[model samples]
Target chain A: MNSAAGFTSQDSATRISVGDALTPEDVSASSAVAAEDTARYALMLGDDCLILAQRLGNWISRAPELEEDIALGNIALDLLGHARFFLTYAGSAWGKSEDDLAYFRDEEDFRSCRLVEQDNGDFGKTIARQLIFSFYTHELYSRLVDSADATLAAIADKALKEVDYHQDHAAQWLLRLGGGTAESSRRVQAGLDAAWPYVEELFADVEPTERLAEQGVAVLPSALREPVLDRLHAIITEAGLNPPEAKGAFGADRSGRFSEHRGFILAEMQVLARQHPGASW
Target chain B: MEETDRNAPTDQVPEGGVVTEDPAEHSVWPLWEVFVRSSRGLSHVHAGSLHAPDAAMALRNARDLYTRRNEGTSLWVVPAADITASDPDSKGGYFESPKGKSYRHATYYKQSEGVPHL
Candidate 1:
């Protein structure tokens, strides 16, 4: 557990090693509470990570190879950890626990964007989703480190490093799959085509986030679009694949309106908690 | 080193496209040996092995396999086939020559009486 690099800590003794990120328990005990708008903003971020983690978790035993299986599982766990941090902070504002927010929320209450809820069609498609999601977070968290709220800033700074590794992982796979054999290239290209339309929904300015962005507590999602798109195009070209020209999907909002896959993902995620209330492992 | 007939077969590598049990697909990544440095000052010890397409991907696989628990400060991956080892069947010739040669050892000689730092 390496202590978070560049996170401001007034007490040097508390600092540990790399990857020793902030746990939700730390957020629970801390004095910093999320403001109303900041809570709503954090909820969306948390939900996105939560749903994607669920999607990634399905690959634990199903990835193409053993090495790849472990890689995807580790990534799923990291996303879950990020979700815990954000959800715990968000829960602070509403007198709820992280589990309460995660397990009890209905499909309509979830504020996650459509991109995360989209299906992991194949290994290539999953990698495509990972590329888009990780690159987007890399940009969002990079800017979010400077948020006016100290806790959000700290969480973002910590999550940024892990997300950067995720971006590298996805980009490496993209290069390999896009440039390998003819079949590999075709599958990965089709993957990009399947996932590209959902990209625009990620950049939409939704609810409390748009307001929080004005106060410097949350990043403006639209501001991240150009950089994420440009990098995606450059990487896609470098891998010898054409940039996807798919039109943006309709009804791209954080209101949980656009996606049909959200319910299935939620059912799987919330089942154990819902089945046996107050369950602890 | 063990000097048995079982330790002498290095020529019996399975040919490409002959992997039978994997069932799903035939493309098998090459095996890579992983070494991990536990901390800044420590030497990298043999961690484990994994299969990957290339050296760059091998490093990433090594990280996920050996260093996921923060057990390493640094990592190195080498293709398993690249590492040549002494033939275990010739261990008697390679290792037994040094046996009963006490005169070649410094402990076989007495230090100078009362010499400083002897």
Candidate 2:
């Protein structure tokens, strides 16, 4: 809402204050398109966080160590927070609620990337998954905080802070397991190799991604790829390790394909909701 | 900061029976104690413990294990073995016996519950 910071020209012409900036009239024809685009992008992001939160949540009372169980639980809560904001925004565009977006949508209708839905394989694999996703999200959120849409910018700004902690958590685990005993180092490297092909999908330029970038509703994932890779390289170097080259063929439509791992993951994730209709805790 | 040149050996088993062993022989890492300062200009308070292979990794593990949800702004990690405590057997004779000494108590001379003469 502070025009001088990052508001679009179209937004600036309509209002002078934060509250006024969100008024219906201030959302221009182009801005409405941006909001629609924002909704779609938010769903994609919300699904990523939701799925990852589910995966991390499963680690509670089951982590390799007690300390790690609590740590992973906290990270899951942070991701859930991000999911809440993004899904709330998505629902707002359609005159719905966050609960409707999260509960009513079918699995096929979900827009998350496949990486998040893949099962939490091993402790090493989970850390590897977190390392890749957190770094990617951190870069995206950093650039997205400067978005032209006020609500999107606000969400991005808040998420960026949370994602920084998430990235640091993953980075620390990566260094520890990668540089430690031979078995740990080997296993963690194997996990990275398994996760690498999915990493490329994260940067692939897709239609929704392109449209959202044009309207200033989302940061282009491709633009953030370089910095994310550079950071990964630095962490790997610091850890005295190398990620194995990615194996397996690249799948089409990164968002469309779920690996062999997702079935079990979804069964566990959706079980409680499916079992209890309209249940409140 | 320069790495402190500790006269203390990096690999020796401490008096308390805490020892570091190669990963080939031992599966678990040595425990490290964590301290966190919640914000700038605050004293570090004892947080918890975690395990890691070395000091750098220990510090990192501390960050992840202790400060995940913005609970801390700064962290300090020390191998749990490095900390020395006075013996519990000595507590009764050495610590508790000294508590009642008149000179040490600040409240020995009580002030009235009013604006006191400075």
Candidate 3:
């Protein structure tokens, strides 16, 4: 998701398009936040959006149909919008710019969940990933509108509207693919089974998460997981789909363990930059 | 919602009209028409239709299907059949006449210095 090539420029204009169309000025308005704290919070939220956006974008021209292709593209756009806000916030913390943070970061520098980095396996797998991520995002953004951090609050306020639509999109598809023809139902079940192991990693509490949670600059992913899973369960049952059985943690890392699939995804994702260090469009 | 007719149970819609039932009664969903308005100055325009389990799902589907293109500031989804219309082909019975109300024309308005634009 990081694009160092795109970050080479220093233009600040892209960061603050809010008043004209989409504004970053709201983020520029000082919340008087501590620089390091702001950077951590920004990276956390920004990486989440960016990684998810990348995953969804991979569906372009590969979805089951044209409508789904367009739908996933639209969802990716919304997530990219959110990533811009959070990365812009991160940039402001260091007196840099949004593109600087997005395109300049290394893989180790990202704070997104390992689940998001898993490769898209199939249509069912994509929806399974979306069902988990969209539910988490919808609730997180809904609570974040009231965050003490003004910039975070503003970003959340705007994004909550978009996420509301995203949640609906995932919910309907989850129902259809889960409850549809026998073939679809079986694949969707398999998708959820493959995806479920990574879900727990998203909620694993890290020290950075704990620190930001106290500042009201970050919502605790651990605290939100229960409600997220509850909602997921409700939707699955309503759709006549069985919840995938929980798999034991695959990694003992603090974020739990990433699935074996992640290395391949990162390899593909980072290849362009690795191959051509200074490449530009 | 496009699914209305599909989702409607045996009694939901009269047979042979939008919904038909097999003995199983496992009708799919109902279809609803979608409308959207960009702002106060704009009239609601048809966006698209979708199938959903109920009204709430219909609205949600409409929002996803139509508004994701940034086409609307607001949305409305109504069961397609709920919309009533007069048959244009049968309008000859009473549609041609204006009831002879000459005042309905703008010729009655006169321009004056006090009402320059009018």
Candidate 4:
């Protein structure tokens, strides 16, 4: 519950103490003034992590095993930490706090991709989604460590280590479920097919992200598609599973327009917050 | 500490042909003991125990359970069965000698007070 380090008074007071929270001193003076594009870019990454964390949290007591419960819970907590930091930083651009942004925003106002918004179908399906997303995040965050924006770079530096472990967790699960039993292999393949269509939305070039990438404040999503896909392809092949040939969901915009599952997710997540505004435990 | 006969015969098993349970039939994973090193001065202390199928999963589980609050920099997970503990009944015989050995303590050397780095 340590206060996030580098944030100003205007930033959300949410306590997110993962690896050293970016203190105010960590952010360069030039990076203090967040551009409109930078804030929007942050929103995209933050929303993605926030929604995925919520989905992962659903597996706390319901995972296939107890050890898996702890594993998923840890990953969910780490994602929540990343989400809090990004949302706090993004909120600083306007007068909004993290709570105001997360709880008050409507479904269309969220900027997360369809990959994260997809429902956690089963253990295998969740693993499939995690494998894809974690691989993408690993590549994205690895590049983001060199960002011109110091705060973003610092966040990425801490996030990269966590994402590496997350990637390994998903990969291990994928291999086990893919090779363990005939029924398990079938379910895992089905899970991969179910989640494959949403992968394309993750690498789509959005205007705000593209603009920020030009300024060296963000990594370009389109630039990450090839390497991430290559790594995922290798993992899927090594797991003895056939790569799904399903077509990507077309023309789906992450900025406002979301998948059908997002509304239900938001309703569950934002319900208590919207119900009792300004109430604290 | 008092030493009991370590090779004492067990009375729990009677002479009658009683059914012995096989350990392999149990499907549960083996337990692992977790130790976490919090800082430079602190040794790896026993955090808790968890069940995992293998060493890799045990280490990962240890990380998830013990280090959630950023409590440690390093972790060590050993199979619970690998550890050997002294019999609690033999505590008196094992630990008795160190009790009155004030000469073994650095505080016993009172004349070294003026030393820079005793």
Candidate 5:
């Protein structure tokens, strides 16, 4: 791969975005340590992205069209990048690495809300799941940009821009699917019906984040409920479908205990890392 | 690898493409030509083509296909069907008409007499 076109290897390597910006690497290199509560909160956010990213990654080659495959893959990578940032910062409090937090953790140890762990049923269902989570995350990160913790603020600032696009992508698909045809509308509505019950878990104001929110280091998830739901209902109506009226499912908490899909997701994700513990290319 | 019926499900189209039992579900999306500007103050150049349901989806698909590696600062996706292109068969016709017509060149006019910014 030596350069025959006159550019040096150094130029090739250095031509990547050489801007001063927050990255997972930058987070890892800093002397900043997350307080115990902050670390736990970081894990909750990180685990959400990590698990959902795996779910989205399954669509790489399976999407209906080639263009959609790349679109989903890009989003999966964006979520994975956010996961890296949060998990890396969370690891700082415990002297572990991002990989350690991501791969070595057990299902019950995870703090991610159930909304992200839902199956990607049809494309309609996937977009339905995406619409809820993206809208919720977009709202969460918008307020988190002003967090008391500098590290959390920086991470939120960086992740928000991507989350903005994620919400748009989900919304576009939602509108298209919900308005395309009778069958299309029906399936997407079914998707919303299936996903709506889990929406409550996203705003539970979980233990660590609840305390952090009081200290102004985290955005209170409960505060996001009305706005997110209002927007979701408006968009669903605009798409000509009734928003689901189902109650939030029974164990609407981030406990990971009631989640039927989390263990199955983790087994597939963790098997390779466990089988070949320090293996690398 | 041997080729088999990659799409034979009862719900899928029998032969055309990946549309489903919904007979009105268009099998193939329209193609779009994507143009990307590498940075500001630069004209967009053709990057590639992709299939999308409409103009908005075309723009997004263009973004995913062409701008993945920081290659673009802006994107433009035009419906491929809408663009009127010069005939490739015109290589020896109209395009060649201006090529060898040296009188059409401004280079022949040795710089304007007193044009300051020419």
Candidate 6:
């Protein structure tokens, strides 16, 4: 069923109109200055999902098993859908389309957390990253469903259901890889350790996010940290794996300071879109 | 030469006993037949098949593949090997009787023409 407003059943069947929930008028009605902050907040969320979706797409033919291949592909498609909605709504404020926001942005302009920009080293490493990110997204979206902004609330309401499945997918893989064999357990443990340093940056409270949270238009990242970490630690312990104690990467997301790997990811993703301007199939 | 010699021993069969390959060794995940209920009033119909490691994964895979377009409210997955079917050779004997039972059809009863709920 289509959850977003203004989407007819016919439109939902044939295609997804990502911007169905919000109109240009709705965005323009809000104060232009406030709209800018909301737009920036939306960009942070949109960039996170967009980058992770690209990472997940890389596993289409490369997952360890065929079932996992399809599973990851489905999750990637869902994340891409979420990214499109957020980007479209965010773009409305600046008179830009979803494609403009996604394709034209440089690596420094992206607001994705360091965790999502990290390399998907192996199945184990990818699962470790998915586990942390999905749990955090689950909490974030759950709270955002009640945002004062109707458009943001609608987008979050739809995205929250999909994130539930993503969390389950990552949790299942984490359990299996952690409990499977001696070598498997060792690799996944190492994967968790490698990804642990990036976790804290996801909950870092930046100025825009803080301002938006106060206005009831965005979820406070700091508020999600305790519950998300508590749930993640329990799962890690249950899987017979130890949670890593590492310092977080220091920097505000979307402030031109990004993880080292973000540049390479952006270069590959934007190459085609940048080469062919205003082109569509 | 030593590395090649070390691998060669594994390829050799032991004396007297035949070397049997494990059937599960080279097999992928088992295939599952998927059925989906489009809505509350509809019966579950066979949708398609997919490969998964277990029942839980099979169900999840079916949901992703079949219901991505909002096609179904419920899903069922059965291991392909568990289903038993009638032999094609016995199709005439098994299904012939129903063909000749014209009285079972509503159209065969002339008196039912005037009945509203018939």
Clashing pairs in 6: none
Scored by CA lDDT, what does every candidate get? 0.88, 0.75, 0.73, 0.84, 0.88, 0.84
Chain A structural similarity (TM-score) per candidate?
0.93, 0.83, 0.82, 0.90, 0.94, 0.88
What are the DockQ scores of the candidates, in order? 0.44, 0.14, 0.09, 0.30, 0.46, 0.24
**Residue B10, model 2: Cα distance from true site in angstroms:** 37
User: What fraction of native interface contacts does model 3 preserve?
Assistant: 0.09
* After superposition, candidate 4 runs with Cα above 4 Å error: A1-19, A23-31, A255-258, B1-26, B87-118
Better of 1 and 2 by DockQ: 1
Give me the candidate number with maximum TM-score: 1
Better of 2 and 5 by TM-score: 5
**Model 1 per-residue lDDT tens digits across residues A1-281:** 21333344333553323344576777888888898889999999999999999999999889999999999999999999899999999999999999999999999999998888888889988988999999999999999999999999988988998998999999999999998989888988998898898899889988867788889889998999999999999999999998999999898886766678998999888999999989875
Interface RMSD, one decimal, each candidate: 3.0, 9.5, 5.7, 3.1, 2.2, 3.9
Candidate 3 has a TM-score of: 0.70
CA error at residue B9 for candidate 2, angstroms = 39
TM-score computed on alpha carbons, candidate 1: 0.88
How good is chain A of candidate 2, measured by TM-score? Answer: 0.83
User: Which pairs of residues collide in candidate 2?
Assistant: none
Candidate 4, Cα interface RMSD: 3.1
Interface RMSD of 5: 2.2
Chain B TM-score for the candidates in order: 0.70, 0.67, 0.58, 0.70, 0.67, 0.69
Error of 6 at B112 (Å): 8.0
TM-score of chain A of 3: 0.82
The deviation in Å at residue A248 for candidate 1 is 1.3
Q: After superposition, how far is residue A247 of candidate 2 from its true place, in Å?
A: 7.4
